[model samples]
Target: MLSICKIYFMLFLYLSINLFIMALYFILLNMEVFIEYNLLSFNSLSMVMIVFIDWMTLFFMSFVLFIAALVTKYSEDYMGLDKSLNRFILLVVLFVLSMMFLIMSPNLISILLGWDGLGLVSYILVIYYQNIKSYNAGMLTALSNRVGDAALLIAIALMMNFESWNFIFYLDFFKNDDMMKIIMFFVILAAMTKSAQIPFSSWLPAAMAAPTPVSSLVHSSTLVTAGVYLLIRFSSAFSPMFMDFLLFISLFTMFMAGLGANFEFDLKKIIALSTLSQLGLMISILSLGNSDLAFFHLLTHALFKALLFMCAGMIIHSLNNCQDIRFMGGLSLYMPITCTLFNICNLSLCGLPFLSGFYSKDLVVEIMSMGYLNLFVYLIFYLSVGLTVCYSFRVVYYTFTGDSNILVLSTLNENSKIMLSSMIGLVFLVVFMGSILSWVMFPFPYFICLSFVMKMMTCFFILMGIFLGYECAKFSLEYSIKAVLFYNFSMFSASMWNMPFLSTFGVNYYPLFLGKIYMKNFDQGWLEYYGGKNLYNSLKMSSSSFQLFSRNHIKIYLLFIILWLMFMVSFLII
Candidate 1:
């Protein structure tokens, strides 16, 4: 029954892809659809649900469902023997549904439903393993997302200043209003959190505690991209100051992630950080006033990044859960298919020539070059590209080349047909998705005219990155002086600049200390004395006085009654 259900879901997903493609063509012909309904209203504020679907929605949704289907089918074998297989499948399905809801809705209220749904479902999936690491990772993921959720809620509250809750209707309405600008600022904050930019970045790596399929689905296509997509949808509302701020934060995030990936050893984490770097790239590009380019990169990165994680999953499964790249080498000799796919995905990530990543990435770089950027920003962008290639090659060299690092008797190979078939589905897409998507999305190429040095910077960086990656991965540890001198910096980069520590303990220290003070001073001190202790003491004294008065005799009671009667008579006379 489980097998039948999985197959049915896959078949249905594929059918939907075909239908969506046909719909996309129709949408391209400018036959768009807008659906809106009023569910409820409270005086001026109305609960209006709006869905605006053009070619973009159909196209991105098809890709998302396609990936989800493949991941679901892959999980059939990857998680086949697990006792909670049904639960896992259900969670993935719910995740896909939530993403679909997010894609279709343009209403802030409706988007919140999908946004919160993704956060809640993702947290559940992250901690599905029930281990301490997963638990901590889940907490981090949930709390980080709550920041975005709060931001979104505040933005929605601010949107009430306008008559409509549908932000699609009022894209230009908030431009001149200071209050509206503040709301849009919160909206950008929400996007930054969802996309794992800057401070929110610690959650993306921590979320690797999830199964690989979830990582592929969440980190690659749906979860992290949620922020970029949101920003893209609302790009017109962003001010120049806001864009500049985003550009700064995003560049730092890109540089940081790229640098961190180079220092990383864990196979999954290296890729997770790569995803973060690409996210930074996407958001930064979007901030540069071209949502189309950012969207292009978003789709292409989804293809290769998902494949990369799936390949990592296969390798980890083969090695009995070994994720450290140092213990993996010469895998191309035994696991030829897995290694080949890994190389392809890694190269695509590096934006090599004609692969999906190259088309969007190269264009982004050239366009960025033409922009009015400062020296520092330009260096960070180009250097991040170089670092991307550096880490990609480093991963390839460590895991696929050199001597065998696996057990001598181990029979590791790409024998899992289920996993391979799922990957094979995306492999074709990752290779040709760029050209096809380019032709579909753009009628002509972006006219980028630059100097010889600027035009060739990408190639130069690629070559340099290859050299740097090889030397660094090959001899960084072996050379005594280099290792000793750079040990602290290496550790800092490896630890993601202590982001995990900062997110967990650094952010918690003050809050926890304040909580302790509240417990001592308020709960146990003033409140205890004034409310609990003082109330008890006053009650005891009153009871003792009443007992003494009662013991004195009937005269006391008679005197009290006379005084009460006199007071009542005087009040009546007045």
Candidate 2:
């Protein structure tokens, strides 16, 4: 206990130091223009918002402190009893500090460096569990993130050649039409990968292979949101093509993930899919060129998503590390506080009115009413919201409200105060997030209230989802690869990941998966047959022939045809 306290104290103390430095940097930026300050740095010179919104950096960093506190306290219970507990705490501290630096950076070059540092540390934490499975997931996650890094670096190279790299520089000067379009392409591709849109969505769901605390920070708070945050930050120079690209990709990711979460059995995997769905919504909202819509959702999503993940973690922890929601039930009987926090998170994620998610969710829907947003776009976003409710409620009902399946009644689950306290505080924020967002004035208004009729009508979807999700739970507790892969829930679908067993389980399904198997074999056969003997023998026979042209009647004919065409052109010219 003393060791845990010491670790928490050190982390909190370090965060407090960072917070203090940010405040001082902010103050210095606001000071009347001095010769000394102007010579010190371009970032300090260019920042105009420092006088007023500089504290926003401090606001974002407060969450860092909160997460660090949770990591330190939670590690004490999960690891402090272990021999290497202190090392774990040190690593967590370093990871959060890197995130703070990354997010608060003012310049593009600084931002890229900070971004790489952030990815490296989070990659380390994901594999810190040290299992082979964790290592594999970590490597795949790192590789996917590196795709974004490459795109970002390429954009930087282009900017340097054209001599336009900083946000302030772009705002003040340099707008070449062709160069701007090229830069936008690289920027959007990088953002899409980091945001986990569609094909790149494979990685985030696999990231559930990480520890629970790591998921809270990676999915709920920072890494996944970085791309959308960048989109919101650098949206000024976006052309129409860029916005259209962002809109379509964001909607596509939403539907793909929303459908997949419905079939997942693992508790963490469900939240992971839900995270993808939410990120999709976030990017879609930002793509509309409304900074308020993007920023409002950004703040609200953090509270509710974090609350949901922490609650899911508590439920899994209660079962002696069982993760599949199939075996979990009757948790309301065992842990009332756990159920209450879980319900609050679900309400917010599902966009229950007066909840934080409702404010941002409604704002995005309302913005869609403008001629700019088509019905097809609105339909996808709204349907994903309904599906979001379906899966989120599926988690709560399957894990808590239903009959007991593996109910071991030990001393009741009061979720290790370390975890519960952070969750409880977050739950409070989730309940009031809309209230806070309604007051946000960073840019345009995203605080539009929905009419009573629409609010009343939207409730029907949530109610229907809950009823259907409950009904679906009773018949089948089994998991299948087809269900998992189709919905992109690769996290908990290990059963058939390698061995498809597509035919063995009384199924004639998915000719595509079988085609891939044959394709692999087919490619190898061509390589061995042609390159090894057939093609090699053909080459040798051709070489051994005394007269190369005499043996090939077809080549001699082609030479005459080419010479005739050349002769025709020469005659015409003469």
lDDT of each: 0.88, 0.70
Best by TM-score: 1
lDDT of 2 by residue, 10-123 (tens): 667577557646645654564322111122447545422111125445545665566557656655665545577666667776776666765665556666876787678778
TM-score of each: 0.90, 0.75
Best by lDDT: 1
Write one digit per residue (lDDT tens) for candidate 1, span 1-574: 4584376456757766785676557657977779878889999776666888877788778888888888988898888778988889889888888888998888888889999999999999999999999999999999999999999999999888886677877788667779878988998989999999988788988999999889989977898998999999989988899999999999999999999998888999999999999999998989999999999999899999999999999999888888989888899988898888888988888889999989999999999999998999899999999999999999988988988787787767788899999998889999999988888788777888999999999999999999999988867647734666677787789788888788666897898899999999989999999999999999999999989887987888899899999999999999
**Segments of candidate 1 deviating more than 4 angstroms:** 1-5, 40-46, 409-411, 480-482, 520-574
Error of 2 at 223 (Å): 0.8
Q: Per-prediction count of colliding residue pairs?
A: 0, 2
Quote model 2's TM-score: 0.75
